[model samples]
Target chain A: MTASRFSPRRLAATFSLGLALASGAAFAANEQYFPLQSYRVGPYAAGGTGFFGGFIDYMQLINARDGGVNGVKLTWSECETEYVVEKGVECYERLKKGLNGAPAAATNPLSVGIAYATLERSTADKIPLITINHGRTDSTDGSVFPYVFPLQLNPYSEVSAIVNYIGQKAGGLDKLKGKKIVTLYHGSPYGKETIPILDILAKKYGFSVTHIEVPHPGTEQQSQWLNIRRIKPEWVILRGWGVMNPVALKTAAKTGFPADRVIGNIWSNSEDDAAPAGDAAKGFISITTHPAGTDFPVLKDIDKQVVKAGKGNLQDPKRFGNVYYNLGVVNGILNVEAVRIAQAKFGKRPLSGEEVRWGFEHLNIDNKRLQELGAVGLVQNLKLSCADHEGGGAVRFQQWDGARWKVISDWVQADRALLRPIIEKSAAAYAKEKGITPRNCAKEG
Target chain B: MDFFLEVLIGGLLAGVMYSMVAIGFVLIFKASGVFNFAQGSMVLFAALTFVSLLERGFAFWSAFAATLASMLVLAWAIERGVLRHLVNRPPITLFMATLGVSFIIEGLAQLLWGAQVHGLELGIKDEPLEFGGVLLSSFDLFAAGTAAALVLALSLLFSRTRIGLSLRAVADDPLAALSVGIRLQRIWGVVWAVAGFVSLVAGLLWGARLGVQFSLSLVVLKALPVLIIGGFSSIGGAIVGGLIVGASEKLAEVYVGPLIGDGLENWFPYVLALLFLLVRPAGLFGERAIERV
Candidate 1:
């Protein structure tokens, strides 16, 4: 046989050797490995880039400022999900493995559909999955979902807060008796989650609720908005995501609906969504659990340390002030706090997935904690015990004034008294479906 | 009466947008046997280039001219690099090659101008104009006029130009056209450039309608049903088919939808196109090609 420069066997051997060496380097590093399921390229990329950019920037900020949480470096590998569930699954499978034969410290699914798909797998793999904003609402019931953490606001709480804000807008809770409200939502589980609560509230408050579904990547909404125009709803709530939010806003504007009366859900209320609509988004109200803008001290630190030092992921550091970006920073802070809290118990040497779970279970972020972290008013006080994964979130209302979002309402708390039974009912249904026994909150640390 | 008129006008305008994209498909399919699946990706790429160039401080017209030049280069490269090698190959092979080209273009667009949704404001005001008590989107109306102008221009080119005759001859029979001194390569290059122009207009209209994002690539899928309703090889068919699909779906959704469920507009067009397919296999304007063994 003639000798060749790149024989198949030799090439295969070289590729294998390269992988071995690369994996060895990763294993040797004294760093905490975090696999980020980021969606930086899709219809949702505007939101994704802002949020994911903030996420990576804050992680970089942590590594640079604090010398890694408790002297251990934070190592992260991002896999793009593109807001598609199948790609999310592929990303999850690809990055589930960690350095030194460790279970992945944590994974952020970032999407509800992806979270739903990975629920069983993550439980089996024993990796603590963190979904700060959007995920399975029942996952907040830690008795059933041991691995998943719906940190900030579950859909139920979010919807109630939105409803409360609407009540506040309508003058009072009792004043909403005859209000005609419509919810233009993205047609997915994320969008569908808000419907049940709306239906329940409609009957209770005597408001005629009509929600319209916009299909995925909703660019076409002429007919839907025309219907909204005909319905003449007093208030139209937008439970949309990705490009759908702006499209809904624009279409609603085209249909002659006033911007202030049309409120967007937390997912729909961000700089990414409103900026696209431009003047059409002026006075558009939306619900948020946290404050927006880069006015926070921690964000300044990130800008000073990470961006100024040229270690930040954002191409434009000015995007650091966006609503989604601030949310991302909050997500990173909660994650790092969980690690720090976990370190106190697990001896601080690159925590296992299980140790991270314990830390998340015992998590508490009161105003005092937020101030200490330099994030004071950016986030509302939160506590996540073994029973409540959501930790009782409250949402504030903000309205876009053609430029920046101005806070319109105070932190209106969700009626946990109402949400608890609903949460337990669904969580019990989930437990029964999966043949899972409820974790004894008293029995575990 | 006003509601009906408004809905009808809206649908027709929406149809005009669909026809813009469908014309790109028909141009490629008529000139060459390949169904240009890359038309959507081309629109996305063109929009990304146009927006990014403008963002980089190029004047509006300068950005437009630069985008046009880049699209011409892309068309030429595609014809030279992909189509030239696949000459005389099965039409399916060429279609698949275009699909590959689309994937390549999508990746290239994302790589070059990072994946972020950009608002391509082409100075088209989106405010609804009240036309005799009926609400009409000025932007959509302008887009419809643009599509009409484009169709008229394409017709004039075909009926009044020697290059168009050569294209028709090449499309009719490559071998016979070659015998008559027509260059197959040149015809394909012009056809691709024409299709590229169609994509740019469609991109500007759509990028203005919805901000430019990866989702623009999927908007091309809507044209498939349009092509099915209209014939794949006829420009007139594209306009008529797009109008039919658009009008019927809107009318149906507004009147007959809520009884079943809301958002019937999503699948109504496909069902209408499929039903039309069953009645006329050759499509509304397609030539009936018969094979005898």
Candidate 2:
């Protein structure tokens, strides 16, 4: 029946339609989307599943427990990259427009190849590309890479921290003088990124260093290890990935090299890397931005709230607190915190990718904040600025005991004071090559 | 001199591992006249299945038997689904089919077992044993022994058995063999099944060396030069090719590598294979194909 606009029934219908429209707008405006370019079925799937699972689980925990951060719901959708660069770029191009009217907060691919491939695209989209714990060393200079955040650690800082750890182990920095060290690096851009920095460190410390390259998917490394044996280096810095780590340890054993002297880098620090080598990896040490284990209060909460509630993202519960999984949790914490910090500045709403970049730049998680977030030891004190994308360059050393990682040292800070000049120099070269004006950090708010 | 001996011995052992992978390719190529690029994927699938079973509390032999059975089924399926449809097709067609099969098997394996790196402990110690003045890997020695045993058994199977004669006949001329009532399907099925078993052996050895993961499929790259140098159709040739590739690449990396650049071991074998191709088009052991112009 046709009714008058002012009639009681007509008025009720109009009011209901208005409420529905308003609620829809609120739902759209009060959500943040994270485009996950994840690889859960590939050579690197062990890392992919653990990391993305942890990231998704942490986000789920936030949604279930906190009802979203400041009433802004966290949402994400995955595009399977299989850790391939082309697929990652395709995923970024596909998902960068955001989902369901909600703007994308960031894109985390968790791959060096993919991250580098999408660096320009993410910048063009004004979306923050978070490459936590691993990325190009030059990306540390945030002024040149405004939309890129190599959070926690960059490759240069990682190597610097490794050298610092070596120095510490050798009694002092001066004791490294005239000592021999070998760096057995994977054959890739990511693996070769630190060679120059290593040479510089060696010159500064007066240590004799040798660099050996192992080709990609490094399943065989007999020649390289034999070279190491011949060099008789005091320590071997293993910059390995995937199967290379296990093969290195096994070959090192065959060459009569003590496993305790082999220091694995960030990528090689996981249980996936060590367990395959069995007893050969017993005393192997590696540097990590975050330690693995379920002892953290945040992890306990996640286990109780998200996992027990049957909303967890992980397929296997055993990997809940593993290295890659914990890194994913730490990444989730950092991403959410950036959103919260941005919300504080830009009002409580779904902020744009540009706004998230500002939040990332101003991120400063001190000891108190770490404790408050129940991530005191899980995450080190981090402070990012307009000029620095890597908030924390510190790492903790851990040793494999044939089963799990045991934290062996407190947070060891990288030589950022020495690395900044090099980072700026490389960044300036990049800026010139790209014909882009670098951002002035001092002038930025 | 001692360092030279050590490097040479290490290279030889490493070559034996490559020989193990090449043997799979040799078996398939000899029987079906198709270069099974999927042999690498088969290795990955076999190892992943076995390790996955072990993780689920199956004993060694049980897991092994289950994996063997599954591989045989996979062989049967490949013969029925792919090879049967493409009878009398060009060699390139069969090669392309196996390439497609590789991707499917890789995806299916991961889909079924999940993509986690599993450590395989064969209870053989990998420590170095001092042989006179040179240090040698005990694990390498054990692997060499296994390779020797495998070669001996394979040689006997190809030369002595009725299936072996039928397989050789099929390889020479499938049409002729079919005309003689060789039951080409049965021969193909048997060869593929035996190739699957070879894949299982190679998978366990390579998996123990480089964790059971997706990269296990990439070990096929190492087999390529071996296949070229040893001739694709000869199991004995694969062994000889592997030894040459392994020893030469290692020795080159140690000696000639520093003179040029480092990390030549990956490509040095290719250089040797290219030279071999230039000098002998059919390879040292490969039979020269005489096609009527």
Candidate 3:
């Protein structure tokens, strides 16, 4: 087999075969293609595997069990980013549409930096970018961020809930006066997103706030935890990512800061983070919008249809009902529900990017609706609208018991009324800087 | 004063941990003239293999033995497949080859052991021991003990063993050692095996602290500066260099970091190593490569 044997004729024939196979797999009438930006390889891969795995498992189960979103099968493909912003955008440009030339129904940039990077492009592409538990805090303002949806909770609302929960823990908001609060944050845009909101709440409630930054891939946090020791703050708000969360718990224990006194943001709430830290993470508190555990009615179906059928992507079945996994399931449900709602108006055919965008804006997953979907206690009632992309979701605090996470607090709404001016202010600043014309939803609706 | 002592003590403990990995690099570089940039990836692979075996119902001791056996095989394979071919190559070429090896090993480790994070408990209680009002991590003290024992064993091996003498000769002059009829390839194999053993120790310690995952390999980046400050081919220098980098970075972060919005621990080590290079051109222990032109 010399070079003379590999003729152009043979090359053309092979090329034609590949093209024919690719074209044959083109757009179907009742199938909605989704492009999921996943980071299965990276420093944060521990969280990525469980979250993306669970999300993918849920989406696959829906196709296998219920056949899809109202007879329209969901199709999706993943591009690895390793959580790098540039790679995320590269993935977006490559996967913005499928082989059919039709744009994807929605894009989920799970990383905050990716969400921010994709915000402008998604709007220009007329595709909905869902940043479920992350993204810019101001993206909560639907008027400014029309194409972007931070569905469950934006950073602002999420941190506000943490502050409100802290108030509850102290007996009352009035008692929060003169209390010392510490914000141990990952030194990134995602971690810093909660700082301004904390400052706002701290001032309004008369609590003093001190925020310490933890550098990325934060496998060590001795200095910051020791600072917490010196400051002796009553509460520590841990806005961490990946390994930082567990290190924070361990350092806190070593510093004699009670794990119960430290509250983590949603990103730090995963079993991946706590499980590694072992007993040091016991009594560690974090916020959540979705319920954790395998006892959920939806997971039962997922187990039978997805896991039993060998369709689930989980490496270990033990991770089936963990925090990040459940969050992935919730994220999958949210995307599916939006598609189902879009199908209501856009006919029984495949939904377009615009129709799905409309669906995300008008989604109403109330408790009763959740009950009907077999997600009874798994989801809280969410009502996203033209002006509120975040749906004003409530957050519950969960504490890590030795082996598992258990809910420790009732659902609490963020001090949203106090946060309204701040949200609008930041959104207005973002609009001005980006020269984005804020949509008049009152007129458009 | 207690606060200062605590910070100082914490930094030294961390330095000891970093040296555990740095020594792995020194062993190979000293004997084979290869930087072995894959040292971190090797650590990660060793830990991942050991823990993954434990997850599969192997007892801890059996899993550990299997991991060591795997490392032994790995060292032989590297010598036979890669290093044997690249013998006497330019230093940069050998270095680049090891980088490629690192990528391959990282991918293989993740593939063979699964990409999920696994908790590796050495059953060493992590509670900090208190003395007068200062706290010291017991696990770190245990790590220091491990480091000390390994140092003693390595000292004895280098001073008394026949193979160790041949390795020193090879390091002194490869051509001369070849003229003297020493099997240069076999020494390279032995050097890589020793590196592999040191890597396993470093991996288990770090994996116990940070858990066994793909990111465990990134510790190599940290070990590079330790090698620079300590000398590329001196095991004793690696220990001292790790301590200096570790303690100074911690103290800098605590005392000077907050003044500059903090997070100096990330770059302080590199800057310190760079400054140290001004004083010790060949590192604190590295030999100067001189030509009698």
Candidate 4:
């Protein structure tokens, strides 16, 4: 039984069989993959858990009910990021390498800061960095960001939509002339992205803009509120998140500022944000990309097919209607749809990371398809091309009615013709700094 | 002038919270000559326990009682298990041990209750109490009142009761108290347990003001200035010191925070405390001791 006594031909055959077995296991591991970098432990866990749960639950529903995306079983693994950028990067590095030597098709970092930090690596890796609703607003220049895809409307477009709503409310765009608008923003990159757009708009509309910053992990904001009181702007757009949202609302109530005059970004518009301030946050307006409430057809389908079957992550199905929860579901749906599109090209089999990028780049969701999926309430017709990353800057306004948010404005598309040049210039400058080239989108067009 | 007055009131109110935490440090130091760094973590632990129980559908009173009972058990266990073993150890060893305890408590809290920030509704209204032209949150007023009452109760207990007398004897000299038939072990246990309850009350008030999170443990740093300004062993000093530090820091942030990048609130008090320490190490109300060799 010694190796020296054994025949060389037999040994070689045994080794080949072992190699074949290992390769078989590797192929088996590559069936379907999506990596989730989550933060279920940290200060932002309140928002994180809701979004992560929704993302996971929707994936689970798709896998269990539809038998995976186009017959390729959808599989995912979550790594805790703790809302820290370094930990998020670490998680990405660990998870991106994938199981059994198969690379992950896509990654949802969830945090805007983490997304921004990992944007470069995603492009280099040729894996789609799907920042569903947040990231560097300039990354919407798909030509420059080739692999980085902000699936939903970017912050700049969202701001434009908000301002458009404000203009409409003030009778017309001319009414904004000589009006003073203040932006009370959280002191971070997420908060800072809105400033340039607001400043540009202020100049164009003959209005004045005031920029006040509230530091991150914001618990104390008395002075910032005091300054806001002194300024007495006609409108205040809040870019604050977490505890900062309620604190701002409570402070505004104390200062006798009309709650209706105060507006929040989509991140700040949530049941968790409003519950803390209670009545003070009532009537507060916020820009929304999707309609709130779980009455949508997609949600009903999910409830019937997923939860009713006792296979959903939601402890309470009612939470599916929350601003963030709904946002998460929408994000999940987009990710799934992208995978389906990839399947159409790469066959009804599990697509690779590069193939998923193709799926994201060529997504086309018409109104008819949206209606069929019961997501008519969630989003408008969205189509992404090689040169255009944002798909389109379409959003609406919603107002809080003490307990819930109700849509108050129709879908308003941002002036993409005006924004394209700006996005390109900024994205090119970023590319220059990073020593990268814009992807050639002429062929795709 | 009105702004100055307003700032002062806010500072004093904030000071009451600092003192509440500082008093816990002062009590432990007085009884055992050790600074308990775990005081802040104890606050977080107690607050999280109370909030988690309440969220799980426990009655407010039941949760409160359960939290207090748990804290008492914790204090007794720590005293018997760790502190009692290290009674004759150096002050640095005790400090390091407390720091270790802080981490252990923090991890245990996260393990027991997931790391989501819980809203600690003290079942108290957060409305501002208007007085003429000035206004203050009712929560702040309650906090100030509760801290004062607790301090008074501790003072009365230390001065009026026989057990208090025995406790004071042990604090003055454990060896002498042992010779005089005072049950040194029991006295130490009672003091630690009482201090644990005080830490719980302090934690709840602070947590109520700023929703309960693991970061609530850092609130103990706010109490350090109090211990520095007031002597380490004096209870009244801890209260007054906390008030001075809290008020001064708030006022500084109002006047000077704009000049800086707005994080002065975190460090200004420590700077003032350090300056005061350099000027008067024994503190205002600290006992002036003379060593004869």
lDDT of each: 0.85, 0.93, 0.85, 0.79
Model 2, position B246: C-alpha lDDT score = 94
Summarize candidate 4's per-residue lDDT along A30-102 as a digit string, tens digits: 4677788987765676677778777777777777777777666777788988789999998888888765554
- The 10-residue segment with the lowest total lDDT in model 4 chain A: A217-226
Q: Which stretches of candidate 1 lie over 4 Å from their true place?
A: A1-29, A101-103
Q: Candidate 2 — which pairs collide?
A: none
Candidate 2 lDDT over residue span A1-445, tens digit each? 4557589988999999999999889776678999999999878999999999999999998999999989999999999999989999999999999898789999999999999999998899899999998888889998899999999999988989988999998899999999999999998898899999999999999999999988787888888888898899999999999999999999999899999999999999999999999988999999998899999999999999999998888887888899999999999999999999999999988989999988999899998999888998999899999999998999999999999999999999999999999999999999999998998889997
Two-chain DockQ for each candidate model: 0.39, 0.81, 0.40, 0.26
Candidate 3 has a TM-score of 0.94
- Per-model TM against the reference: 0.94, 0.97, 0.94, 0.87
Q: Write one digit per residue (lDDT tens) for candidate 1, span B178-253.
A: 9988988999999999899889889988887777778888888779889998998899999999998778878887
lDDT of 3 by residue, B79-167 (tens): 99998999768999999999999988987887787777877789987777898999888888999999999998998888899998999
Best by TM-score: 2
- Clashing residue pairs, candidate 3? none
lDDT of 3 by residue, A282-394 (tens): 89988888768988888998999989998888887787888878888988999888888888887866777888998898899887888877887667778988888888557
True contacts kept of each: 0.43, 0.80, 0.34, 0.14
Candidate 3 regions off by >4 Å?
Answer: A1-27, A100-103
Model 2 chain A worst lDDT window (10 residues): A1-10
Error of 4 at A195 (Å): 3.0
| Better structure of 3 and 4 per lDDT | 3
Name the lDDT value of residue B240 in candidate 4.
89
- TM-score of the A chain in candidate 3: the value is 0.92
